[model samples]
Target: MSSDTYDFIVVGGGTAGLVVASRLSEDPRQRVLVLEAGADTNSDPRIKIPASWVSLQGTDMDWGFRTEPQPLLGGRSIGVSQGKILGGSSSINAQVFVPCNPAVIDHWNSSLGNSGWDWETFSPYYAKAYTTPPVDDSLAVKLGIDGWTGHSSAHGPLPTSFPGNPSHPIRKAWADTFRANGHYQTQDPFIDGAQGSFSCLATVDPVTKERTSAATAYYHPNRARKNLHVLTNATVERIRFDGEDQKRATGVVYNYNGEHREVTCSKEVILAAGALQSPKVLELSGVGNTKFLGKHGIEPVIDLPGVGENLFDHLVNTTSFGAVDDLETLDPLILDPSVGEQAAKDFAERQTGLLTSMGVYTYAYLPIMEHISGEGQKRLKKLLQDNPPAPGDGPDQIRAQAYYKIAERGLLDPKQASGAYLSFIGPWGGPPEPGSRTLTLCVMLSQPLSRGSVHIGSKDISAAPIVDPNYLSNPLDLDLFAEHMLYIETLARSAPLTDLLKHPIIHRDPASDLTDLETARKWVQKNSNSMWHLGGSCAMLPRQMNGVVDSTLKVYGTTNLRIVDSSAIPLMSTANLQATVFAFAERAADLIKEAWSQK
Candidate 1:
């Protein structure tokens, strides 16, 4: 092999890409190379401070991709923020570290035809990705985390902690309100997929109060290893194959510093460019539908039609209410510039106050039927009965039918959480009053029935792919999301939680009054936005089922090529995708190690 050749070439030095590179390079004999299109922003404070996450979007650190106008969202073009920095979305995200509903993972194996991917087998990888912060006795009781015993793991590369002031009234109020409603969590969510309210974790180092991104946790620590090499500002155009008939990825063609370059890999090529861009890479390399490739003037290598299909993302709608005057919300941070100085001082001095938090401390995963009324329940049942899964035996239809069956079962089951709700301690879509604070309730559809696609618009790799999430396109999705939105009103009006808000319920947006199902539906159509938890563009299942990759994360009809990112997740997780993405990469690294070790 030449000096430029390595054992493995990993594309997109993002969250999953870093994890795989770090793990694969553990053996001294193996040589690994990582190509990242974005610059290394790991040292930037905007990427380090937990509260600075929101500011990183639209800056140099973000990809700044926008979705096509959706008819359901009043024809609005939503901004899809992807991290273009070294850590990828993990560096730019809000840092909520939550797990997928275990039941959903079970579906990946039992229903999606991916063996050894069940919750029991995949759960261990979650433990391998992060070490949970310890909860003190007093804080545990206050946060309702006392019941969460004997579940957390103390070993992992990433550090996870509960962000914000532990004694913040919102934390106790949230837990008490859920308990009063008989919806308090029964077990730790990390260990069991229980549906209830609880305080969630963030990827923040407890000691340093800095963001624990994949770059900081995985890459930075292992970067000194001689076997590992990383190139930043290197944009991979496509995979370089051995030949048209062989279909083996031997190297990659990337552009760096205004010059195109090629580097060969002796072993394997891993694609971790994320859900939005991974499919673009595969399609550009001639692994997609021949018709689509030919349209872009690219010759075909493998005729895989599922390269960019089955796109899934969580859609969220937020409603903000006025908070009590005494409560400390993040509103002042934006409204008052002086508050920023104090926050900076407080963080520098003691690692406390607004700088240490993102003002989103509480979360709940609840079943739709449990929150809706009897009439609503009947209506939901009728909706499901009236519109069954798409009828067909073809690959795309089969995949859709399988997802519909699983979604239907969970939608009806009281034990399953169809909606993920969280409380943010500030106004979300509207401005706050001069003398008043705000509390925003975000209601998200955990499992969406609608599917979309991301495909290349031109042969040029620099051009962004066309993204259409097709959010709320399915009739059931609109109705189901409306039900969840209506429930948010109930939660806000409920006990202890209501105490945190002002009397008479002063809403940030008067139109957000979710009085009835119809009103809620109208509000959702206009207000809902992407949660940025995109996945499944390159799913893992049988090839006949519109699966780009198989159970082993290997692309079909191709050797030495695999996808180890959110793009390969068949079913989107229940809540935030960072934790799930971390676990998935951890498991993929093990799988890759096992595969090559045998050779």
Candidate 2:
């Protein structure tokens, strides 16, 4: 029996996994092990250079899972790619690091009844994890002073900053455009207000111009510690239970170096696999929806019906226009050999240029509802009036109900769910034309009324999970998308945005007045895409609500087992999930530490 034993075994060496492992091993005596099914990509160039982010998708670094053909998305099978590298999605995702709406977190505590998990409760964790360069004195207030620990400094190691070299001069114009449209403008995106147009902060070092991923930020610094062991290319087959009762998790079975290996955990086994794969992992371990287990010919160890349900994410609809002038978009710099050579030389020599900026560093958290025309509002109001209660009593259906209620509230209040997320960055693939510059207006749905599911297609963990995001299944979500789409069309043609554009109407034809809702809906249907903000597949609701985990982040119907990733998120409450997720891991670590200390 060639095996190893540890104090804790964290499944999935991704963002949350690394955070938990590093924190737990800080005790010096605890032995922490991290099992990752992907290769360590610290040396990957695509990961370090901010501009090369788009190129990493669909490659070996991506999990490459596509949704079941969405009935609402023109029957299209959209890709819901997960990160398949050491840092996980953080290593592959765009470097946009932003804050979650405080109200949304408050909802999880007050409205959804998740105690000890609110804005005030978790603010300290966020402060403990986020660090910025050229430190702002006001950030001193963001450093957990809101009554949690009286007062503290921002001591966490993760660094977030603006573009190292510089941003395009147009950033001022972008800020002016938001202000012109009556939106609140901010110097820093992570603000107490949580709504407004602001210059975005990237999870990159200001000096090196490299992505500050979970591995780089949390794990690598602590790698020299002997208590923390990271096993790359290690696939956890299933968690082993202490007994046939399946009440307690004892260890895990994994395949490493072409051989099955077992590892015992003296204290606990936490599953930090992301939303997409975490539920599948539970199902494969016989701890999911009983009916699903029966259908898949797996013995049901626990009837936790919520393990792989409640999948949802922001559905982004993008429109790219031809800009009159070059805007430092990655297209030309990487697409053209001569320009790419210069970019490479500059990056290596000076750590600057097009490669440093991710092309887009500003995000407008717009209150799209207020900006919508009377006609659009009237149409949406009538539709909301007619929306039937989401049909099933199942957990997924209950989640759909909660999602709609919150989204409806957001329409009336920007502080609740942000109205929409807008960013500019694209000229993707090939340029639209020769010597043509590009400007992409990305409008993202902050609170989608859609619910989907993920289940194991095979007992094999290596096989892709059956993902059905069921996008736009709820007409209301589509209605919001349409409304925002039409609104952005107007913004693109407005004074500030249009004044800066070389060609206003090149890529888009806002010819339609959108007197009817269907006109806007048709346009959005043509251009909708996932924003890669996947979560809620394994929610943390009340047990009767089909929750896979509880507010304490402990798995329902099981002891010594927990899932501490986006999978446990009750809803997608943020735009970019990295900041929220890192903060979440910090909080979870405290909870685990408390529990272990009591033992």
Candidate 3:
């Protein structure tokens, strides 16, 4: 086989891989090569346009993987759309840029046994990844960001700004409604963890009105560097490992242009193939559970059994209500072909109109106790106490105990947010009635107790992995999520926000009429879908705790193999995964540089 050599070989030229490769090539001496299984569609309009995010799904750019039939979700298979293009999911996500709770990052070290992974140590990297747009006084008031100060980052590769028209009334209405309910944010969520309602930033460039993704921010600008090479449509089959006792990744074997090729890396092989595929790559390289590998007639180089365990994702249920006719919403763009044509024309000429935003502006992160009834709170507490992690000493049991303890404390704390709610000014789940407008209220479980897995389905590298998120599998998850779902009705009926909506609210989906807790639970069981914020498949924890990687993100049984994507995130982020993934890649780059500087 024809072969090439480099200092570092990065698998999957997606979000994290591009960042690491770009950073490593800055030295002008280290040769770095990135292999991506999908084609480079960075210039495609569906990826660049802010409102065209939804249209990218099921296209060539999307992997279009679906979960195994979820029993709790009524035997329905939820579609998980992962990006199969240059920038990965960042190129196709809804672009809601938000942060994880500070406490969750702290838990990575204090409870999960990873040192130097706390909020203080990890927060700076968020600034290193993106530059927050300047918010003027008038715009701040309109966007409910008047009280925020010193939260904007002046220097970064990715540009973020508030999407949509500045005159949109829904923005102020959401702010005033939350303020009236005494749930307005006290501080900026980006600077410190706040549990109240506030406007969020989007990964869209204000000047260009285009989506600013990893390919646009990190790769395109640095592509001119001579030492950095990125090849799209290249699928890495497995890593080539050497060393008798200690397996060290030397390079990789990949398929390109229908031909098998080999490339040698002298320093390391970095795996950044995202949450679902990163673990598959490790397992394919003979690094997963020995018994599982034996089933496929493949020998295992490492006996580590946690390559695809502890999968985490945010499941969301959306409730849409009829909006007043006078209010402007995205419904016109969908229901009227003429309106969509005008919107496209406006975007082409002035970079304005319905095409500029995804219609998701306001967000609220709330504790379960804030919305549940007093009796419900008592039941939740009792339920938690009654089910204190299974009694055992095995690694799985110990991990479960640690996770449960943290979840229990956070669920009870008034300051910690357990659920996230957001507002969308348009129809969701189904098409709207002719000439009728709508607004969607989306509720998501921020910290779910239920865990799932993603594993190799067969020996072929082309086959999709078996992903089972086991949504609502934990009883506590259902109880807490139902309460949050019930709160949607209260939020929609609240004062200034209600003025935008019609009286006797007409739901887009009849099942979304959550009148009581029981109805809410039933709706959730039938309607909840993935937010696509997947992570923790190859978790970073101690080996005894079934951790696939260590604190430094190096594979547990390999010296030179490392993972630098959402897959290595020990916990799920509270909101969207884009911001956290960018920050993580920035930190991972520094970790790689620091490790090699010592050598």
Instruction: Please give each candidate's TM-score.
Output: 0.98, 0.92, 0.98
Q: Write the residue-wise lDDT of candidate 3 on 1-599 in tens digits.
A: 12399999999988888888888989887899999999888898778778889999899899999999999999999999999999888888899998888998999999999999999988888888888787677677788776665465547898988998877888788888878877788567778765678888899998999999889999999988888889999999999888877789988999999999999998999999999999898889888999999998878988889889999999999899999998888888888999999998998889999999988988988876443567756777887987677889888888888899889878877768888999998988678889899999898999898889999999899999999998888888887899889888888899899988998888878778888778988999998999999999999989888998999999987899999999999888887888889889999999999999978
Tens-place lDDT per residue, model 2, 112-168, is 658887887877776678785554454422321111112224557788776633435
Alpha-carbon lDDT of model 1: 0.89
lDDT, candidates in the order shown: 0.89, 0.75, 0.88
The sequence of per-residue lDDT tens digits that candidate 1 reaches over residues 132-191 is: 887777788766676555456647999988898887888788888888877777667788
Q: Flag regions of model 1 displaced more than 4 Å.
A: 243-246, 370-376
> Over 4 Å off in model 2, which ranges?
1-3, 135-153, 243-246, 370-379, 391-397, 414-418, 428-430, 508-516
Candidate 2: clashing pairs of residues = 324-502
Model 2 alpha-carbon miss at residue 554, Å = 0.1
**Model 3 stretches astray by more than 4 angstroms:** 1-3, 369-376
